[model samples]
Target chain A: MSLASLTKDWAATSYGFLDASAKRELRRKMLKAIAVPGCQMPYASREVPMARGWGTGGLQVTLTLVNPASTVKVIDQGADDGVNAASIRRFISRVSGAAETWDTLSASIVQSRHRVPEEVMREDQILVLQVPNPEPLRGVEPNMSIARQMHADADYGKLWLTLYEQIVRKGRIMQGAAYPSMVNGRHVMTPSPIPRWDVPKLNMAKHLTFLSAGREKRLFAVPPFTRVEPLVFSDRPYQVEEHAHLTCRRSGLSGYFMNEIPQDNGGSTFEVSDSNLGIKAIQKAEGAPTEIGETWYRDGEYSA
Target chain B: MLTVAPPDAIELRCNSTFQALMWALSRPGDARVMPEAGLAGIAETLVDLECTVFADTPDLREAVSASGALVTGDVSRADHVFLSSLENAADQIVQLRCGSPLYPDDGATLIVAARHAGQRLRLSGPGIEEPTEISLDAPPAFWAMRAMLCAYPEGFDCFFVDAGSVIGIPRSTKVEVL
Candidate 1:
């Protein structure tokens, strides 16, 4: 073949900020990640404008997936207005000519750091989580090669022992976020630093979730209707944060995950962690038309 | 303001093609429409210089080779395999790579052209909300060989294409001949 047949017309930059080769590599890895639900697939995490640890993994995945028709949303700790979230959202839209939305319901693809939306994600929508650490066994096993062997053997005893020690020392399970969860009965994965309250949203849920860690250079998936069981002893049941009774100081909504603000008086007030959900609640209260989708939690209880 | 390059036609086509493949593989047993009919788009979307691909057709092999991926004659050595028809390649089925437990990503992806209308099969796995049944035109030997070759967490993923419609069956899925 001649050079003309082999080469394309030169462009200033590749679409979505990633070269075609990078996207193809990611596409291959992503397919494998979905094939084995909750199993981390190693990828060449390509460089972006952002830092490696600061949501670059999620950004790459979004860039690979986004198109002009895609409605994109990015969130940092459940707030779309956060600088990190806002910038990522803008960059995606600017590069791809995609529509941007803070409302989870309006988004076709939701990329976030440390939170799933308060609204239930539909089967059609995709959720990409910015994972700081994709490996659930990293805490117990430092050597990655051996850890992969353990994963191959399906030997999760060390993970269980970590939980057991937590109970013995703290009188309860003290591990907060990035809880180790068993996915599809075979693989255990870190659900990406999301709070215990938000973990159940991924269990047998309608939406497909991709968890990617750029620094780690690995990505994994939790497909729709897959089992995501948090590791817990039968004697001590898995417990979520006790935030059901706390009300959001801004919107007066209760029974959802909250962010606590400590006061000078030594008491603390709580606000809804999902900022967009709180905004919608306030708008509805003011008689503005709004639609709040069904949440995983109902009245502070993990009902779904 | 920083000016960004708009997506060229190739980028847009590959992006949409990948989206279809992703959703198709994510939700097995359900049919997803591809940007174009046939497996060429898939090769362009996924296979690159880093990959070793095996294709039954010379046209597809040439297309894959043009992408800079190594064209392998052996199915076992291929990370991606494209077959014009599964019924014609029964002997090649067992040779497909089913990656070991330590690294399941080494498992190959098989894209075969098959009719959507034929013998019914039941699928249940990560993607299926409940047990869903669909029909495919795969031969019985194909099913028997697939079941024998695949071991959970260590099996090749397959995509059945019919014209513009595609259905993915990951190794995680259990296919029961009905």
Candidate 2:
């Protein structure tokens, strides 16, 4: 009815660092993404203080979800102390006044460039993954429109062919990261760039996962209890990276995904990928009382 | 060096409302409490100048207009539709945008007022670990009509709001009338 009614009071910065409209738009898209699991939903990727490719998509989602009550965690390649992860964590906490934590168990929302935590995510928690490329068909079908059509038709022959070719050439499925996966038995989505070990953590897990790519300007979700089947021939069988046997030289933790550090003399050393888990392992070994939640993997086997 | 902006009342309310709606949709058949009763909180949380809204009631239409969203008379043109009841929503349901397969986000979000208790439904899909049963006031005819209208990856998402609680049934959810 009046000029003042149409506008809001100007703030130094919008809460969560996104304008109200941006949040509304994201809210709408996020709901749709959740509605149709693994289906990519396009949103107006808004600008943040960070670069477009540096977890901006995940950051936006985190910012939209963050509140004073939220406990946030950000990780890059499984380490919370990595520059990108730490900066993003700090940024999220600064903008929203949300609590920040490295421990996956304490985090209500976990945003990561790659890697799901070694610890199992609860039903109430949300995982936000930063995707470099959202389109699984990008390798075969460069045209996004045709790729979308293929998704609509559930025509994933090319995807199968890609796997078949890998079997023919490499004698094993060589997709190390960003494996194409079927969600809810309907749509196939690139489960971000998470390694094969992390893919199973998404399947029918009790946690909600959102994969967003800011540069791509798209987002998708894997709701709790949804099926996330990695593409593989029934004859070949799917294989995760063989890091389960390796132990972390630093934390003495074994049976989890490990980062291979190349030694100067042509050998390789291994360390636990999830830095916080390793930290907790070291602390518990040092006779400190620390609680370690049950993990997705146990004694080198992903029993969950 | 920079000071973060504290969440104002509006931000806090919308953020919480979206959280409720998000969880409601993520776990279909689960009732999540809203910040306030009715569809006003939903409209405030989602509708803005960027949206095109359709509402059956004058109050909601006024509210949408006040939010600076385009108030479309036609249901097909609106991205968000607000209805007082689903019993008489057959006409609107038919015209609601299901969106294209390529752009399912274009699908309209249907918000209807329904009681928390009524006919029971069995829900199984992405969100449900096992088929979960829930009761909603929506009639069998309404669901039948919904099944007719929705073709996966090409259907509108729904939110049933009762007082301060909401239950979301995304298109991915397979609902059986029990």
DockQ of all candidates, in order? 0.85, 0.88
lDDT, each prediction: 0.93, 0.93
Q: Please, what are the lDDT tens digits per residue for candidate 1 over residues B1-178? A: 7676777788888888888888889899989988889999889999999999999989999999999999999998999999999766977888999999999999999999999989899999898988999999998788888888888899999999999899999999999999
The TM-scores of all predictions, comma-separated, are 0.99, 0.99
Off by over 4 Å in 2: none
Give the per-residue lDDT of model 1 (tens digit) for A168-212.
999999989999999999999999999998899999999889999
Error of 2 at B151 (Å): 0.9
Itemize residue pairs with steric clashes in candidate 2. none
Show model 1 residue runs off by greater than 4 Å.
none
